[model samples]
Target: MKKHQPAYLKSHSDGTLAKKLAAANARLQHCDLCPRRCLVNRQAGEKGFCGAGADLKISSYNAHFGEEPPISGTHGSGTIFFTGCNLRCVFCQNYPISQLGHGQPFTVRELADIMLELKKRKCHNLNLVTGAIYLPQILSALELAIKEGFDLPLVYNCSGYESLDALELLDGIVDIYLPDAKYNDPRMSKKYSQSADYPEINKLALKEMYRQVGDLILDEEGLAVRGLIIRHLVLPENIAGSEQVLEFIAKEISAQTFLSLMAQYHPAHLASNFPELSRRLTKPEYERVVDKLHELELDNGWCQEL
Candidate 1:
């Protein structure tokens, strides 16, 4: 929303961001950017399931403190909220932006300008939220931003249902992978998120994320400089039991994997139409998930104090 750059942004000496950005952009021709593989002619302004064409549709950009301690740090994580989402979770907290795709349409240049602006603000990282469909634009913007002088550890904030092919394109481009491990059960996915293959997709996608970023990298000040962080929001009625999710994370991925078990669930949008998830998560429900996670002995991450 505002233009600001930090002093460190001007002294960047990591590597050519344009190369990585090019690598990512090459994958967009067929547009297998996500598991959907919509393959629309994005270059010619063809809109896919995500609503927008090749142009970047951004809802909001700001410094956010609601993230994990490391990502948020003291200053805050510079967050760019991209409109439109691949997954349509019935209980989506940001329904207005995701479902509606309500935002300003920005070309790659304008998008890159936002990156430089964030750098000037002394933000911890460039956080891209719900950026699955706009990978091409993001890559182009990163390239432009690098040329104009902007550098910080990049954060790929996304839902876990991502294409391995798309993720492979982002091998070195993303420093921190913030993916939500939602819908452990396919039933909940089909009924709520509209993605019947959520479990399979999310599980496989998370493994790729772990393979790419591995464990989180913290700075000397204990802020996250790079790595993967998994977030799992506890839903009402234990339908998407957070316990099973924690167990799966411990068994499938590394036990040291960073996790955020959130308790901030409330019936939103069309959720009231459904009987089971018509209200907020109970305190006991949140505590039960926490207890199970502890019992599983997963050694890292935080569960918001319910």
Candidate 2:
């Protein structure tokens, strides 16, 4: 009602951002920032499972229109694609940027400049993609951006495997959450993403995210201001456990939870090597998930027309 303002403004004014930035930066020493718990001190130049160091590596930043309609809006979501991912999903489409680390290093000041620049382009929100590996740097840059009048909403677009501690730092700093419920089955997650703990971590992460921002809130123009937007990319043969994901959202989280049922699966990266993930999601596989969504009374959100 009172004209939605970005959460960081309050966090910054209350001095919460400073504290969160400090605590997050400290995690680089041991580097348990993600679910990986790769205790290799990233500040000491030790590369962990994510292949990220202290320096922030970003692939690109742009006003993207490829997100959900509410997120993209009339302008676009200011997307900052961070290079390197904590998980190694075999079918990753952005394999070059996420796995092979195709990006250039950026200072916190330069990163802050990018945020201001996006705001100048009238982007709806600052969308941070694959940000788990660079939480500290993002926070530091956000602090700088806030000082320079970056008033846009912040979207944490991440693979669902997250650390609760890392998320705690983002309590009031982030406004919208665009996270994936990538896999529901532990075996499938382990086989594809090499993270046996993805399901458990993703579930817990979603809970925290939902607690922070309850349901998706749209403005007068149907643009998202704050809230969680769950993305479940439909995988070939249901390897992504789509039914279980929808069930969890409907029963555990909320039936009204904003969902973006994705049908854009293609055998990229090392997916060709794995028989289970070697093909695009079939019409049947995607339809089944959509049917289940209706069955579960998930009336809110968008279903891709594939």
Candidate 3:
């Protein structure tokens, strides 16, 4: 079998990675990396809706085995949890890290070292969680890590809300896209995530991601090399509109698209304030989504045990 060479390695060797790094950094001057498009001068330490400034803030980094099988592999996916989030999901499990900014800052070179360290640990991939807020810095660190011979697959794990231009910058850089499809209804998205345009934005972003890397491809050892993995967390009272999301994925996107239908939803952060979201997902609600997945004949990826 041919050894799996990460996509970014070729981009780095051909000098496109440097060009991409420079372009990503340039956006910081008038940042519009995410869908928020705050246009704040992030390069000058001005804060936006995401609360990130010039420096990169990260909560933690380690090889995490809790991810899907392809990501975790025999060892684990190298997970870096970044601080602050562009999307303000009221029920976010990692609210402290994403909303409260519970982390220390790091220089670009230090961030590069973290990636190299994960590579040395024999991780399957570099899983960047909640990193849409710090794309420019990520590109810089990736450039540095490439120089240090860190050539693991890059996982662009994120909330579904993303800017097409920003994703274009990552065309040849990111190998795996692990994104969420939180809600199919605009009203539900507005109530939960404060973004009514989430469904449209998420669909476009997913299309772009699918274009970059097709369906999930696993190595002989069942590890993800390159692909699109969509996650849908079932919410209470069918607020997430799981059936519609599954319908869209089956029709609009490929029926062969890999999906991770999650059943872990509990009251956290501001979710307790909302009556509909103030409880865990019921068994019936979760099973309904599961039924839709089977009904749609979408037979790829994993599902959590209810």
Candidate 4:
């Protein structure tokens, strides 16, 4: 059976687009969407540590097969890779896009058009990747897309680094939450993503995501319709980082919730800059995380091999 998809446009007919714009405008004042919380005047053209102002910059947009099975499905996921991420991992794969900030500056209208174009290609949903700095813009575009008959599941494909204040704005918004449970250890997070508090913040953000959508709910066609799907990418070395992440998912969220374990870590962009992450993930490291997954007994979703 097809899962019940929320008609956000019909649900919020009264000034829906306008309200989203206003909210987007409001968020830039304090600017606490991601954990960085630079508190810079984003609206007044002050650049945050994330290197993003109110202007929305997109790196790439089109059908992408890099996502998990459910997200990419058969047709493929319509991914809009945003520019300038909150976390500047030294080993970032798409450093040119995320760090260099490639792509064009788009308004709400252009962003809405991209979403509509993706729906035209039979995309399962609009997968927003690395979009921490541009939540308000994405939401504003979503509002327009909804108004224009773009009715597909919205996928929040994010790194596990986000802010509660920003997430609170997406209360009735996003449908599928595909957040990565990246680093459980604070030292690893700081070394990699430059945030030592990643463990705590990611836990809190995961809780908020679970509260919005409980367990993963798939449609009759096996595509995700709503709910949360937490992803975990195993790194090389003993830094599999599975134990802490698994414990939190099983203990805090439902053990039955969907979990997608990733094994596609390679030396990309600035990986050479960081000695610890200067190479591809070894086979042994991947296998260890897999073994621990079974031990956790939270085998509820997809786990891909490297």
Model 1, range 1-306, lDDT digits (tens) per residue? Answer: 323232223323454445555655775566667877788777777777777677778999999998999999998999999999888888888988998878988888899899999989998898999887888788777767877867778889998889887787677678889999887888888899888898899999889888887898777788886678999998888778577788888999888888988888888888889988898888888888888888888768888876
Scored by lDDT, model 3 comes in at 0.92
Error of 1 at 258 (Å): 1.1
Backbone collisions counted per model: 7, 0, 0, 0
Model 3, range 1-306, lDDT digits (tens) per residue? 987898998998999988988888888988898998899999899989888999899999999999999999989999999999988899998989988989999998999999999999999999999888898889889888888788899999999899899899889888999999999999999988989999999999999999999999999999999999999999999898989999999998899999999988889999989999999887888888898999999999889987
**Candidate 4, residues 1-306: lDDT per residue as tens digits?**
434665355445766546655776787887877788888888888888778887888878999887877888999999998888888777777778777877778897999999999999988888988776887787777877887888888888888788887777666777888898988889888887788998899999999999987898777777788889998887876453787788889888888878898888887877777677877788877777778778878888878867
Judged by TM-score relative to the true structure, which candidate is superior, 2 or 4?
A: 2
- Sort every candidate by TM-score, greatest first: 3, 2, 4, 1
lDDT measured at residue 71 in model 4 versus the true structure, 0 to 100: 84
lDDT of each: 0.82, 0.92, 0.92, 0.81
* lDDT comparing candidate 4 with the true structure: 0.81
Q: Estimate each model's TM-score.
A: 0.91, 0.98, 0.98, 0.93
Off by over 4 Å in 3: none
Residue pairs in clash, model 4: none
Model 4 TM-score is: 0.93
Q: Model 3 clash pairs? A: none
In model 2, which runs have C-alpha deviations exceeding 4 angstroms?
none
Worst 10 residues of 3 by lDDT: 280-289
